[model samples]
Target: MEKFSTHTGIAVPLRQSNVDTDQIIPAVYLKRITKTGFDDALFASWRKNDDFVLNREPYRQGSVLVAGPDFGTGSSREHAVWALRDYGFKVVISSRFADIFRGNSGKQGLLAAQVEQSDVELIWKRIEEEPGTEVTVDLESRTVTVGSLTVPFQIDDYTRWRLTEGLDDIGLTLQHEEDISAYEARRPAWLPRTLPART
Candidate 1:
């Protein structure tokens, strides 16, 4: 996971509500076990239409996505976040997001900023008016800025801290490596050992 202290990039406005996991990566693309290749499958069905927002030239270079309400609404698939991250979206700004999807985003080091609907609309308008305008998402300041406008967004402290430190769940657990080793050394001899077999 990458440290997400601050990101400034072109914002792509995906002006649709109730965007579910299937629409994000589609079920067909879910067969793969690896994470890197999903970029092509992100919004796979929607990209068939040449006029889709992501298919446009400047928007294709966007690293941030500003979406409508109820974003990532169906299923608890973490793949949705994978697809977004693989597609080069570091942050997604929305008025509302599915709880599971938001959690998945945090775990995957993707920033899901929840802001007021007015602010979301404003961001969409600004990006539409100026196609290549840059938007800045500052995790430390908890704000999103575009042009002269800056709006505060909400994110839980723990998630923010994890992202700031680039700590995934495994990385967090490894922080106590010495303590874990110390504890294992003191285990009873009668207890079954859990060491891996040599190949």
Candidate 2:
């Protein structure tokens, strides 16, 4: 996980709606448990066609993705967020997102931004009309600024803190390691252990 306070980069406009987890990383790529190698399999089916927005030169190097409504609306696969992060995308802006997908993304340190449908449409048009159009997403201010419009988005306190500080679930737990160790050391002998049970 990486801190994401502010990001200004080229926005790859994905004009499609109802983009599900299957389309993101595909079921075939789900066999592996590791996170690093999934980038190659991201949008695998679409990649083969060579007509996908991600395959285009200018958008291929983008750090932010602007998509239509109903983004990430399928199975509750955390891998979708991993694949996006593995592909170097930090933020995904859409008019709407599936609840589970949004939660998964936050845990993985990917920002899921919700904007008005009209605002998203405006951004889509702008980016399509001019490739390499950059947008700025400022989490600190909860503002997403395109060329002339700035839209506000809401994020929960815990999720916002996790993303801003790059803290995953493990990272959050590790912060209390000292207390946990002390408690473990103070446990009585009656407490269960990994040793064999008495006959």
TM-scores of the models, in the order given? 0.86, 0.83
- Which candidate ranks first by lDDT, i.e. highest? 1
How many residue pairs clash in all the candidates, one count each? 0, 0
- Clashing residue pairs in candidate 2 are none
- Give, for candidate 1, the lowest lDDT window spanning 10 residues: 190-199
**CA shift of 170, model 1, Å:** 2.8
Candidate 2 local distance difference test against the native: 0.88
lDDT of 1: 0.92
Highest TM-score model number: 1
| lDDT per residue (tens digit) for residues 78-163 in model 1 | 88899999889999999999999999999889999999999999999999999989999999999999999999999999999999
Candidates' RMSD to native: 4.6, 4.2
- Give the backbone clash total of model 2: 0
Tens digit per residue, CA lDDT, model 2, 1-199: 7788999988998888999989997888889978667788888899898888888989999989998889999998888998998898989998899999999989888899888889888888888888998889999998888888788877777889888988769867999999999999899989877679665
TM-score for model 2?
Answer: 0.83
Candidate 1 versus the native: TM-score? 0.86
